[model samples]
Target: MNRAERPPATLTELLSRHDCDQALLAALRERRLPELHFYQSGPSVRAWTELCSSSAYRGYARSFALVDAHAQTIASALPDRPIEVVSLGAGDGAKDLRLLRALASTGRRPRYTAIDASYPLLAGACAAAIESGYPARGIRADLLRDAHCREAGRMLDRQRARLCLLLGGNIGAWDPGDTLRLLRRLTEDQDYLLIDAHQFSERDTLPQYDNPTNRRFALAPLRALGLDDSAGDVHFRLGTSATVPGLALVEKCFEFVETSTVSVGGARFAFRRGDSIRMSSSGKFQGHAFALFLESAGFRIRHQFGGQAGGQVLLLAQRRGAGG
Candidate 1:
């Protein structure tokens, strides 16, 4: 791509063009629950990086096994040409690099682009790829915004083909309708979208979110925003997705036990007792429900990798009407 037309090459430029910094600053200035997504801040990004890398997290290493096992299959499904590997919400780029390595094992070396709003995480991703001698770049763009999505498209359009990764159930955090809309924005015909989701079940769902590691990961931004555990407690509850029946959701909430005040960006907001702020929610999908969702969103599933044990899953899908 021409330098003039290319998406912002650095975090500073991306932040300036997208006003992500300004929006978060404004949210903090107004003392409202930050409209910022969970991965927008440095501390939260670090917390997530740690959580994902920690040995205590199940499949911290095993998650890459799926990529290794399906490497050749994924490579075969793509157009028999050089491709760009674009990872959305790529925290630390751990799983992405594994996928890239697997592709390389299949005799394809793809240029990697890590798309995320967190500058710290984005820099780390690019740095790791470069250190490993892979051609790579980082775009600090918020995935939820349409403008950023367009910028990502421009970055990928320069390649012969594109493989998009939405690993670790990243899409599950949004409302089902918004998730489909986001997917639509992020992909074009013949492009590949690899997304993962936790299998949903009535049992063994809530415990995943109720743990300390997750509480810390989910509350990192709150603490960085200057709220302490004393001000509120982080909790999780199970809910059902109204738009997608049979889809389960884990809602992360911060509920204040007593009246308190939080100050950020020189602004202060008072919270009444018993008030709650929703931090984030993740969707859990049954295998059939996930396939139905992809089909509904105009994607044809090319391959579904991972065991059927009702946990993490990776689905490789192509925009309909094309073989790639």
Candidate 2:
């Protein structure tokens, strides 16, 4: 079928799609802590919202400025046809709105689709997008799963060009191999991929996770599991690795100060005093390391944008070929 013959994609075809409830219940039944559920709880979501507002998170502003400065170029990269702005882990949809507005200013009004594992977050994002006059949809599916990605992609009008977003240093916390795998799953030939990273060097402030707000955000998951401040203390540590040289790692470890028992799935697990569990970690790449990493993952970096602080880097990449 020719592009002209295809029916126009309507907002109804892309409205709120979710499977988070079943995924969360299954994760809980397995006695495992899923990061996806971390934002599902009220406290975690609030803590994350607060964390985003903190002064240290200047990456958002810097990235937005970069996108705005090059809005025309970015928009020109898209096909002349209809475009779909698909943001993974969209959070409150604020950043996506910024990008969408930038694209609009360049005479492009694309459909916006926010994909997140948390239904509440996705719903809020979709609502905000709709209020802002963008055709919007929300998909509550784990982006890491193959089936979910396939289903999410299938929702797009076949002829529409896709711009997949993975922003806010989200990829920094993921394992390198898994990160590559996710990029591969999310992009197809000619599809655009916008990803951000938090750069780290010896000169940059290294102890960001030491802040109380940072601690609260990272430990929010533990709180959702019924553990409180008294149950443990969250600490930050810096480490280096031989495998990925020039990449600095900041890890958050929650150390139990006393004996604690948490109940899950009608069973209890014991945590001895002084036990330390690594909660989350972010890798800060230096110089051209991030570019090389992307190349290694089979992506060709089309453009690079740096934030004001010189720490937040955004890469506009394209899949190498159809298989990618």
Candidate 3:
């Protein structure tokens, strides 16, 4: 298909195939929702929006010099040409607008493509971009799957430089190796991956993830299938990966304070009073750990931005060629 005809799939059309109910039941078998469905529905989306907009999350970003990095340094580093900005798990797309505006200020014409599984969030991201006067497309696909990744990559306007954004600590939601393999399919030799990561701190991270607001967000998927927090309690604990040492994380687990049975789409799951299921794990890097983490993932760090105490980071990395 020609560039004009590609990405013809509207947000609604893409969302039609992304069945949250079916995904939820499949994920229940594992007693956990992968990052793909961890935050999957309208309620979940709204809850996450609330958490991100909360003073704690926003305040942390502000105190860490992230705003300046996004506006000036990060945008200034992009190639001076037409660019196609693609963001995965884009959420509300709030993090993208600043860099988009900064690119525009530099006399660069850039378009946007928001790839997310949530209909409400994806639509908002696309509408915001169009209202802001940038051409945009919304693709509802799970970035965790290889086929979905390549197909979404093809739907974009390939003539321009492809700059992919996995912002707002979304990559930390999944295993780093899995994320690296997923991103490699979405990018090519010259394409760029602009990613965000957070530093670990109980004092700093606890307030962000340990609150009731975040608990609601994490339990949203279960609530969609006739289960609620009343069936269990959400707990946050520091986690470490057996594979990667010195990696700190805030692991959210839902412990069944009362026995619960969930039935959805002709499938039923039973849980005992003492049974528990993992909700999600968000990774936090130590100082300079995120850079080395990305480098080891086969992405050569071209330019790095935003690394204050327990702050958010945006790194511009290029896919390393063979032996690079």
Candidate 4:
């Protein structure tokens, strides 16, 4: 039997076993304590909503186009099977929805599964899927961990032929080498994977960390903790790093340089300037390097789409067969 036919664990079970919230909180605190407080305060939902809905963020649309093309390719490969399109970090499912809608137009009804760690985002995606009359379900799991991958693999095991989607620079944000290995383990011979590969050009400048919009977004949770931006020296800085041989990771760090009163979950604290608060990193990849990484992970590149807005590449890879 294919792995997609196995019974999988529930989202609740995965979350409890992983203890993601605690891990996230600890990671944030150790790296940048203020950011942890801000995240737990919960204004990121609105920020993410705004980010996805804004005209400035057209990356989703481009991603949607690539997904559509990928769906067509997968459909051609497994013409008679129920397509299982599993999206990791699905966000609002806006891009995936576009692909599903396109597939429906081609008379191919896909079983849509969205995997995400954010409950709010998953809920929103489910609602949207319901409204669209699509056969869709959501699994709330952190794609960054192995157990989550195992659970996802079990879920996929229940389906026919599978088509996996990982977009929105999600792979780039995490460790690509590790992510690719995990992905390889989850994918079997019957699956086709579609992952977004972002190209970094010298002309692409980093966004300002403390822009008015960004500051407002970051301040929402802080205010809930009775800490205003004015109550602290909130400094935001932009920097870039490399996660792999050819991938560039660029991100912004929002720090509380100084604060009079800082309280989180009822605990109170005070801090001086020069203290780092919170940081969020976004990733960009070199196309050639991304292709090489995928090949190394045992995927045979079937097709590649390039020349989109913000310089993106879509890789359609199939698992390698035995012996050959």
Name the top lDDT candidate. 3
Model 3 ranges with Cα > 4 A deviation: 1-9, 12-19, 58-69
Candidate 1 stretches greater than 4 Å from native: 1-12, 16-18, 25-36, 53-62, 307-309, 322-324
Candidates 2 and 4, the one with greater TM-score: 2
Extract clashing residue pairs from model 2. none
Indicate the residue-level lDDT of 109 in model 4. Answer: 72
Model 3 lDDT, full chain set: 0.75
Tens-digit lDDT string for candidate 3 (42-145): 77777776776676565335422464556667677778898888888887787677768888888778888889887778888887877777778788877777
Off-target runs (Cα >4 Å) in candidate 2 are 1-34, 203-205, 241-245, 307-310, 322-324
Model 2 lDDT, full chain set: 0.71
What is the per-residue lDDT of model 2 for residues 1-324, given as tens digits with 9 covering 90 to 100?
Answer: 344543332222222223454554455445344457568777888988887777765555655566666667777776676788999878787778877876776666688888887766777888777776777877777766777777776776567778888876777666666667766766777788888887775645455567777778888877776787888887767776456655677766778899887654455567789876665467788778888888777788988877323467888888788465
TM-score of 2: 0.84
Pairs in clash, predicted candidate 4: 3-157, 4-156, 4-157, 4-158, 5-157, 5-158, 255-277, 257-273
For each of the candidates, the C-alpha root-mean-square deviation to the true structure, in angstroms, is 4.4, 5.4, 3.9, 5.5
CA lDDT of each prediction against the hidden true structure: 0.72, 0.71, 0.75, 0.63
Q: Which ten residues in a row have the lowest lDDT in candidate 2?
A: 8-17
Using TM-score as the yardstick, the better of models 1 and 3 is 3
Q: How close is candidate 3 to the true structure, as a TM-score?
A: 0.89
Candidate 1's TM-score reads 0.87
